[model samples]
Target: MMKRIVLCFLLIAFSTSVFSGVADDGAISTGEYDYGIIEWNSRNPSLVVEGGANVIDIRNYGRLEVRYTSIPINGDWYTGGIRDIHLDDYSELLYLDGITDILGIDENATAELKGGSINYIDSMQNTDTKHIDLYCQSGWSWLYDDEDLDGIDEIVGITGLWENDSAFTIGFINDYTFGYDPVYMNINVVEIPEPATLLLFGLGGLALRKRR
Candidate 1:
């Protein structure tokens, strides 16, 4: 009974954390990306960004498949790839939080759930794509140049998602060894305040300090 209670409490805590909001100081702008699955014909990988719904999808080529969409992006497209694959080069990690569903959430949060889709191509065959979508009003935010994983940074994308209030089907598939795992449709979203914004904040802080 104690273990059950603890498990339930842990689940609630995790759920709250997932649904909580972070400040919008460095929030990622709203955007969506979708890529229709393609046959692996030795062509270089291509990505698509859908602005209406704000999602990102990666199409791979194998039995293993994964799709990440309805993620917000504050920076360029290659940001997620650069951070994930080139971690040695870049010292920052991005984050996204306050998401209740793939692209939308209930009113208890700031954003409304919207409909979005993402498609992932299976690696085993030449043609395998998973159609996915995400939608939200204000549930998404991002952080950049984050060296700390203390949930201080904004979110760039989501991982290991299975289901939620929205009707998006998400999960992981195992079809290969370490070298051939399902890849991520990484969304690299970074937020940097403008010089003027920073200056204004600085001035405000100085004023407060003087008054004190």
Candidate 2:
């Protein structure tokens, strides 16, 4: 029981309000970029993208903790290859303590929704949903609006009970009638506790397996 407390602590500590690196170079505004990449085992084990990051890439076992920023991953669609926060291999993404423009999961990657707000999230169009394993942090979580009233529910617009009695919400809009993209969504966190204090992934993988 004691061990459980510690793991939850580590996983929930969202944003230090600082960044370790910005795209491995500088950042780009109102333009295109190769995007920031945290790759391989050679680089630091973790990178905090609190700000100064437009888009990001997490490959191999690198970890990306994002917050307090807007990250747009949908690139020039006509050119193809949108790397809006691509996750591959055993990479992990932890959304905590802030709002991000959007996130896209690809390959055998994993994402943990613990605190932060995510404007949008989806698996790569070509990959199975499981390819990018998504886990809701420790709490009560469920999908909303099963359009056809089918058993299938979406994680994109999730809602539920969080620790500290705080609540998180994700809203979506499909307004193609106005000649818009027709899809807009995000997790808006009014106020989430300072990480660590939150629970571990509801599925309990790395945290549960780790030696306390």
Candidate 3:
């Protein structure tokens, strides 16, 4: 009986350690927006969502860090090609930083400058008021555009134009994909607890076990 109890305790501790660094899937809204950390650990790791907007009106409140690896392309073309990632005018604030070599915007994509401007950082571009094409496998790009013209910038939409054939998969619990297959990429968001809270919980568990 004592051996079984010790084994159960060990299993519980191991499970907690494995799942402590995950965040939950974020939401996109036109009215009230939910803010949290978004993480993708598949081909790319450490991706976060800051905020943005669109006709649907989804927004975020932090910065997004994207790590890239290999991008998927269709047809007999063995050589890698550029993939276009588009952000609409609804995005209030767009800031992006990460590896940019594997992904890039299609050359034919259009950019419309309305009121604000775009700031390019290394390979990444930051904009507060511009619609542009995003290219992969470059360096890093940050976009700081706002749709509402409000002082705060937020991410409004992750889905690009349907005509452009730009679709990605994001899951809060399990893994899900939207467009395309061969299952190239996936984003997983897991919740993370504060260190202080975790420590206190650990102590409480120990105390309860002792009493039992």
Candidate 4:
């Protein structure tokens, strides 16, 4: 009886794994990113289609980092609010490089999703003004509370493709810390079942049928 149960479980697990796909090695590249769509501006940035036009639906990636470049500053700096987001004349507006799996918790932590600005880090030039936006399907809220020394923006959601409100404006979150301005943002992308992680499900069903 126990042997039969184990075999049933293994079958279910194998089926799930086969149906679901694997994730990338967290590689950051300037290629195409697919997530039920063939555009780089999808709400599910972490989820990518390995091949064909199918959505993998990845949830391991829980954060999206928005990066900004300032004059003469190298590497990434920390900014609490929008007061530090700067722009220079003719500099790049903003672009989405990649998504990560980092969650903001009021500490100096690292994230998987990281982006860099195209503009040079020279003090002679400064940024003008540019607004960045985050979007998802539904069931999410964008909250701003930079008063208690916490993170700048917080995205809350239950499930099913959620994005943030891009109407907050750039003047609110940009804040200068020192010689260099902060160029990173940590957006949360909660966990969801991907097609690549459904192996054990099939086994459970098979076991029930055999017993009957």
lDDT on C-alpha atoms for all candidate structures: 0.27, 0.48, 0.27, 0.28
Clashing residue pairs found in predicted model 2:
12-195, 12-196, 13-195, 13-196, 23-36, 73-84, 97-116, 118-187, 119-185, 119-186
Model 1 TM-score? 0.17
Best prediction by lDDT: 2
Q: Give the Cα error of residue 134 in candidate 2, in Å.
A: 7.1
Please identify model 2 stretches exceeding 4 Å from their true place: 1-43, 67-83, 125-141, 146-156, 171-212
List candidate 4 stretches off by more than 4 Å. 13-19, 24-108, 112-165, 168-212
Q: Model 2, range 1-212, lDDT digits (tens) per residue?
A: 88999877755542221232334432222233233243422135465554534346677777776543434435432222223466677787766555454566555666766655555665442322333323343454545666635676534365654443456664443333534231222222333433464335533566666745
Candidate 3, residues 1-212, lDDT tens digits: the string is: 99999999987775444122323343221222222122222222222322221111112222222212122234211222112223222222222321111222111212221111121111122223222433222122222337647676543222211111222211111112432111111111122344455789999999999999
Task: Compute the lDDT for candidate 2.
Answer: 0.48
lDDT of 4 by residue, 1-212 (tens): 99999999997776445132223432122222222211122233432221221222222223222332122223222211111212222211122331212211222222221132122111221123212233333344443444545655432222233222221111123334543223323333333333334446777788999999
State which candidate has the highest TM-score.
Answer: 2
Clash count for each candidate, listed in order shown? 39, 10, 50, 36
List the RMSD of every prediction in angstroms: 20.7, 17.9, 24.2, 22.8
lDDT of 1 by residue, 30-128 (tens): 342212111111112222111221222222221111223233357443222111111111112111222212221111111111322322212221113
Q: Cα deviation in Å at residue 136, candidate 4?
A: 17
